[model samples]
Target: MNFLQFFVWGAWLISLGGYMGRNLHFEGGQIGAIFATMGIASLIMPGLIGIIADKWINAERLLGICHLLGASFLFYASTLTGYDEMYWAMLLNLMVYMPTLSLANTVSYNALENNRFDIVKDFPPIRVWGTIGFICAMWAVDLTGFKHSSAQLYVSSISALFLGIYSFTLPKCPPAKSENKTLLSSFGLDALVLFKRRKMAIFFFFSMLLGAALQITNSYGDLFLSSFKEIPQYADSFGVKHSVILLSISQMSETLFILAIPFFLRRFGIKQVMLISMIAWVFRFGLFGVGNPGEGLPLLILSMIVYGMAFDFFNISGSLFVEMETTPQIRASAQGLFFMMTNGLGAIMGGYASGAVVDFFSKYAIVSGQSQLISRDWHSIWLIFAAYALTIAIFFTFAFNYKNGLKTVKEK
Candidate 1:
């Protein structure tokens, strides 16, 4: 159920930008705003929800209820037309969905630890299935042609509905308050103090910057590939018709690359690993700037392959770094802080900014009665994003300095 929950998101998240642009006729800024809701909701609501689940409610029950509510909102969202209506519904849905990510992890880790499983060895295989689930959902959407239809929303809703009900069947996870009498310490906010450390501060700041880049492409890449449908010869091309499936190559690569993280980080150190991530982002965006979905499909494929390094290198390695460096007492809170900087503030800003940039590129297409036309300068917009990623790479290469060393803690 946990894996399927994220699978539904992976299926459509990257492709929706394209659908909105090519099929729904939304403005760029508006589309970005829709994606921004995820970050916005995560920023404000997840912690509060965590508090409720920890203190007063059964975590499993809360998880199930949240998903039921989220599924309904998503179903309602599919019925709406226009950016305004869609944005409101998505914001509501995200509020319900965002916290589940954390809750699911909590439930899984608690279950594994309680059962005395060898988490380090066993958990990787279990987690890898989540990637499999994501790939399966993406393939389903592409195969069914739901990537261009409102039915994709239904796919996610139905999955959420199933998971919501099934969550109740999981081993009971009671409120932690019964074990710990310290109510004041349960609030989980004190880790915010980590911002005081200079290195941690820099690490987190860059995290937000990179986080901004994370969803921008997801928001627009499919749309870019689909835009080729406008070119007559490429309209029925396989790449255009099955862009979501092709893009799943990135997720597949992600599965392989995550395994390489320990080796790469051990060999190169955090600074270089992060630098590679930034450089890969440059290529990831630049490939889209120059390639077409038809003859240039190889470039797109290469871009997807590199996506593993670009995404996993920084995010997973960075998290491990935080885990290694933080004091144990505040570790959980610090992790939340890390997420806040990256996925919360960074995502919200990135989502909105990417939209604005896309809209800027499409400025030539003034609103006609019912449709928007493409600008001759479409490629220019992609190049601009590529340039931004490159600039970040250059700055990171020079500005950050950390010794190259893999410091792994041996398991007992």
Candidate 2:
């Protein structure tokens, strides 16, 4: 079930940018806007859904129904031809799907705690399968040639449908009683109380900044590579021809990097770990700006290599820091709020902003016979993103007050 949970996302997340640009021929900004729909939905709905699942419904049942609804919306999205239609469909799909991310974590934690499992020891092996499932789905899309089609949506939708059904069979998690029946508690916004801590406040603010970078590459990198088809030499290149396979390197790196998190967090501490992530982002965007699929493929490959550290370092370590630093009673809510800042508000801002940048750069290009833009200043766009990362890194170093630069972890 965990495998399929991520399988649905892996089938489509990275390739959707290419599909929107290459297949639907939508404006880059509009495509970013479409991706932003997920963030926007996440910002609004996850807390509310969490409240519902906590108060009145079973987590497993709620999980099932959410997937069912999400599947229907995803299938509906695949049928749409334009950005306007797709935007609404995707928004509905994400509203249902976003909460599942948190819900899945909740379900897993609940089950592990109930069974008295050593989550720190056992969960990693099981969670590794989620990465395997993600890789499998990416490979499936590449092999089946669905990476650039509406069929990717169908693939994801079908997976979600099956997972939804499977979730019903998981251990039952029932609603909890609450003494306070106020609006905040009902909506699961009580987690907002964490903002009272200065350290957490700074941590969450940067999380939003980093989250802004998360979807930028996902929303445009494929289209960026595919855009090279405008140039004759790269038009038939293997990397261009098999963009999905090439893109899979990012996910591949993610899997490996996830395994290294505990060590890195222990050795370097959260500040340094997050700093490495910030530095990696500069390469992530700079490589995209400078590399092509042909002669520059090495740089492209390196960019994908850095993606693991760039992504996993910040997300996993940040979550762990939150888990360790915050009190146990509000850990779930703290995590939820962390997600809202990063994936929710930050993602929405990034998607829309990146789209605008891509669209702006695209306008200067001259399109020839094939849908390729000639000699456009894409380097500037990448450099701008690199600058953004650098700026964020600088601010974080100076502003986020962590006294000890490193900490050693004693494994139990």
Candidate 3:
């Protein structure tokens, strides 16, 4: 269940920008808007759907239904050639797709708890398979030439469909028989009260910032590698030719970090674990700024390797934190709210803002008597991203009070 869940995303999430830019002639802004579709759907859907899972529907069944519905949208999106059409199609797809992320977690948690497993320890090992699934999909898309074509969407659609069917075979996660009494509590809107606490508020606020940081690379990483084809010195390099496959190293690194989560969370706790993730993002972006696919390839490799820490430490850890903090009745909604800030609002800010940044440093140039769009200031772009992550890390250090903070949070 977890593997196919991420596999559906991995097929198109990393390489779609390359396709849009290379084939459809999309500007950075246009492409960013398209990517921002995930944010839009994420912002709107996760919380609402979470409420449904909490109150009415079985989470596993909802997960299945969502993937099945989303598969059709993915198929339709693949047929689109225009930016507006594609954007709307993707938005619709994500409306169904984004909620599945939290739902998948909820279903997994339910199954684990029923089986008497420790969620914190066991979930990461299971989640690592999702990362492995993502790596496999990235390799599949890259090697099959789907990385630069709409075929990636077909790949995603097929995966979603298969996962949808397979989900029914998993244990059902029906609505928890809860004691939430008021209408608001019953609807799961009480998850919003988490924002009232100072520490939780600070955490969510930074999650939004980091979430914004996460989207920048996802929007441009593959295309960044593909851009090297324009340069005579590195045109034939393997990174340029198989950028998606190369970027899969990042996902490959995720497997190790995912496995390490149990020890890290137990040893360092959430604040420190998340802080490490923030610091890692700094290196993740900084290395990218200074590296290339050749002699600098090692730096790129370093960036990819650090990506595991950057992504898993915060994202996986954050989800686990929410699962630990909340009661079962509202757990799905809490997960939804956490990701809503991360993927939804954070994604929106990252998509549009990073697009502007890329555009700011980029311009069209006449090269070899041809009008070509050149993005040569990637060093500045990645450095700017690194600086942003660094700033977030610094502020987060001072802002979050972890000692005795969890006590206060639980009391509230």
For residues 167-275, could you state the per-residue lDDT of candidate 3 as single tens digits? 8888989987593444445334668888887877888889899999887778899888888888888998988889998898988887778778878776777788999
Model 2 residue 298 distance off true place after TM-score fit, in angstroms: 1.4
Between candidates 1 and 3, the one scoring higher on lDDT is: 3
Which tens-of-lDDT digit does each residue in 1-412 have in candidate 1? 6588787577668777777777788878888999999899878777888888888888888989999998898799778778888889989988998899888877777788889998887777877777888888888888998888788888888888888999999878888885542332333357767778877777888889888988877887777778788789999988899989888999998888998998988788878888899899888888877778788889889989999999999998888878877888888777777788878989998998887787776744546566575563557877887888888888777667667465633231
Worst 10 residues of 2 by lDDT: 403-412
Compared with the true structure, all predictions reach lDDT values of: 0.81, 0.84, 0.86
Return the TM-score for each candidate structure.
Answer: 0.94, 0.91, 0.87
How many Å off is the CA of 79 in candidate 1? Answer: 0.4
lDDT leader: 3
Q: How accurate is candidate 1 locally (lDDT)?
A: 0.81
RMSD (Cα, Å) of candidate 2?
Answer: 3.2
User: Compared with the true structure, what per-residue lDDT tens digits does model 2 show for residues 1-412?
Assistant: 6799889888888899889887877777888999998789877888788778877898889999999998999899999887789989988988998888768877888899899999888887878788888888988887898988999999999999999999999998887666334556444367678778888788989999999999988888777887788889999997887887898899889988988887887677888999999999999999988899889999999999999999999998888778777676677667777888889889998988888777677753435523443344678888888999999999999989885533532231
Report clash pairs, candidate 3: none
* Residue 367 miss distance in model 2 (angstroms): 12
**Best model per TM-score:** 1
Clashing pairs in model 2?
Answer: 230-372
Between candidates 1 and 2, which one is better according to TM-score? 1
